[model samples]
Each structure stands twice: as C-alpha cells, then as structure tokens.
Target: MSEPGSDHDAPQAGREPIFMLPPVVTALAGIMLAIHLATTLVLDNVGLYQLTLWFGFIPMRLLAPDQLPGGFWPLLWTPFSHAFLHANWEHVIFNTLWLAIFATPVARRYGALPTLVIFLVTSAAGALAFAATTLPNVQVLIGASGGVAGLTGAAMRFIFQPVMVGTDPDTGQRVLLGRHLASLREVFTNPRSRNFSLIWIVLNAAVPLVPALIGQDIQIAWQAHLGGFVIGLLLPPLFERSWQHE
Candidate 1:
C-alpha cells in the first residue's frame, strides 16, 4: 500500500534475484574489503599507522599546514584517498554493507565509470565538509561512509517509482526496468522520500550522542555524511540528465 501522498504504491514491481548487484557495486565492495583486510591482517602496526597518517583526512594538516610533514600537498589527494581507508573492521563492514545496498542501483543506472566518478566526487566533497566542521582538530577521518551516504542520497531521487523497462509481449504489460531517475521536485515532494531523508538525517545526527553517553572516545563524522548526501542529492543529474530519457 502507498502512503496518501507517495508517488507510487511501492518501488518498481519485480522480484530481484539473490545478489542481483551490478558489476561496479561488486567490484568496489571487493576493493574496499581487500584493502581493509590488508591493512589490518597483513601490515604491521607501524606500517598501518604510517599509511593512515598519510592517507587519512586530517583537518589539522590542512588547516594548520606548516606543522604537518607533507604540508599542503597532501590535501589534494587525501580527500579522495581517505575513502579507501577505515579506522576499524566495524567501520569497513558498515561501509561495505551500505555500499552494497545503495550503490547497486546507482551503478546499474550509470554503469561502472560514472558510478566510480560519483563515489569519488562525493567522498571528496565529504572530506571538505568534515574539514569545515573540525577546523583545527587533529583527527583522522577515514571511511567509505561518505561515498556510501552519497549513493544513498542519490538513490532517493529515483528508487520509489515504477520503471518502464519494455513491453511484455506475451502478457501485454509493461516490464520493470532498471533504476529510474526522478526530478528534484519529485524526490522532495514524495512522502516516502521525505520520510526516508528525515529518518536518515536523524539517525546520523544522533550517532555522536551514543558514544558520548557511553564515555567512549569516538567521533561519528556526521559532517562528512551530510556533505556527501547533499552533493549526491544534487550531483548525479549533471552526469545522467542528458541521457536519462534515452
């Protein structure tokens, strides 16, 4: 059943086969996992620390450039590099799972090349967002959450409506197509999308409080999540709109 103001009764009608993931989704997930495994299981502590220091997005390094070893040069690449690093197993697992769920549809819609671009671009945007909030703090921000969040936000623009794949000649009915991209107004106006966005924002914003309540020294990086999501919500159209109807 559809909500009173929802655009559709439910997502496109179809039963998806198990692991019906696009190649780009599968490949990216595998790469994240492999890198995490190597960093945790293969590399020694010193090596891991060095790698993290070099690759992780550190706000202090960029804000107070003279004190850091690489100076300002690292800023250009760290935004993109940090997406491939994770602070722990839980972090990588969390990101990979979300990536599988959200990125699958996007990869299917845009194919491998464009999907990769979206992930990297949103992640870079996320790094900047994180930096803006942290200012002078010497903290390492590492995870795929930014890019995965971006994919989730991007999906919100289209995943709710029925897709027209083609005619079922024998049954004389329209088939469920791949992912359908919706307009900006459609995404904001749809009840389902609105509720989804609200829930996501609330849950993410509340994450920092959880660790605080328990006295665990953990930062949730909600700033990066918001940054990626906003960009994801707005950016995909630039890559897709031209060929969307084709």
Candidate 2:
C-alpha cells in the first residue's frame, strides 16, 4: 500500500503497525500519562506524597500499617493502582513509548477487555515480586513498568516468528500473514526470542547493581519487571486458547 500500483493486499490489515498503536494501547497510555500530569500539576508536595501513600504499593504498609497510612481498602487497591502512577514525565513517557510498541500487538490480538485483564494481572504479579524482595523496608513501587514488561513478554510468543511473504499464483498479488503463537519449548529453542528474553532479564538484573557500581541509587522496580515478565510470558497461550474456544 505504501507503493504505487503495488499488488500487495493487506491480509491481516488489523494487525498492529510499527508506528501506529492500537486504540486500547493509546487509551491506556493516555490514562497513565494523565494520572501523572494530574498528580504533578494539581497536587502540592504534601498532597502528592499523601496520594502516593494511598495509591502506591509500599510493602512495608502490610507489615506495619500504622507506620504508613490507610486501612485494608488501600492495601487492596494499591497493588494494581500503582501501575497507573509514575515517578515523573520521563518515567511515564518511557512506558508510553513501550506501550505503543508492545501493548499494541497484544490489544490487536486480545481486544480491550483481555488486554486490560493482562495488564492488571501482570501489575499485581509485579507487586507480589516487589513485596517478595522488599519486605519491612518502606519502598514505594509505582509506574507501568511491570505491566509493560508483561506485555513485552507476551509479545515474544509470536512477534519473532518469521512472516510469510508470497505471491498468489492465481491473483498475482503478494500476501502477508500473522505468525502462530509458539509454545514454551519453541520459545526457548528460537534463537531470536531466546536472545531477546535474555537481554531483557540481564538488563533488569543489572539495574540494582548500578548503585553498587556507581554509588548512586536509582529507584527502579526490577523485581516487579521480572515477576510481570514471567507471568506475561506464560499467559498468552491461555488467551489464545480462550479465543479459540470463544
């Protein structure tokens, strides 16, 4: 379609394009950025901190409720709610770009509701990972990194498969088709996807060690990233099966 008089017809025209994010992905990204903007512009330092106190997932809040704020309700929601909050414009913007890239494909395949479920599930899984690593210590974990990482892992199930490009003998037209979702064994055996996952894990593992190397601590929730990725990697097959049954 980009070329004049090209015989190529879009096979899965609905498939996510490189530059254009699906509507659901765009909307979720908008919500994340909007929340960050609202917190930054509308709330004072005290208010912002208070709101984060209520919304952000602090593992310590579970151990010593009086040391922090809120009651059972806050504990119940913060695990998932923290995914909607971000540390700064840079943080949200980074996640927004990744959402545009990775979540678009997931939204295209799974639709809005399933995509939302995946995000929420992965976000909660991330919180669990964060809590596992930092108990008793009051560390605030906020941002869509976990959910985004989950989406990224989910994308790995098929995105690396080779796209079939061929000319139809009858119509003399070129066609492209989407790839099949690979099983776990296939995922580890495929070099491109295996390498991609390795790089992702290695990068996240390196985050905590940065402070040790440079003596400047960064507030990255690497644990959440890994936890979300684990769930997301294994979760897509269920979605594919669900779609088949539906």
User: Pick by lDDT: which candidate is best?
Assistant: 2
Each candidate structure's count of clashing pairs:
0, 0
State, as a TM-score between 0 and 1, how close model 2 is to the true structure: 0.85
Off by over 4 Å in 1: 1-19, 165-180, 208-217
Clashes of 2: 0
Give the local distance difference test score of model 1: 0.83
User: How many clashing pairs does model 1 include?
Assistant: 0
Give a tens-digit lDDT track for model 1, residues 97-134: 99998998777777788789889989988998998877
TM agreement with the true structure for every prediction: 0.82, 0.85
Q: After superposition, how far is residue 24 of candidate 2 from its true place, in Å?
A: 0.8
lDDT of candidates 1 onward, in order: 0.83, 0.86
- Candidate 1 has what TM-score? 0.82
Q: Which ten residues in a row have the lowest lDDT in candidate 1?
A: 9-18
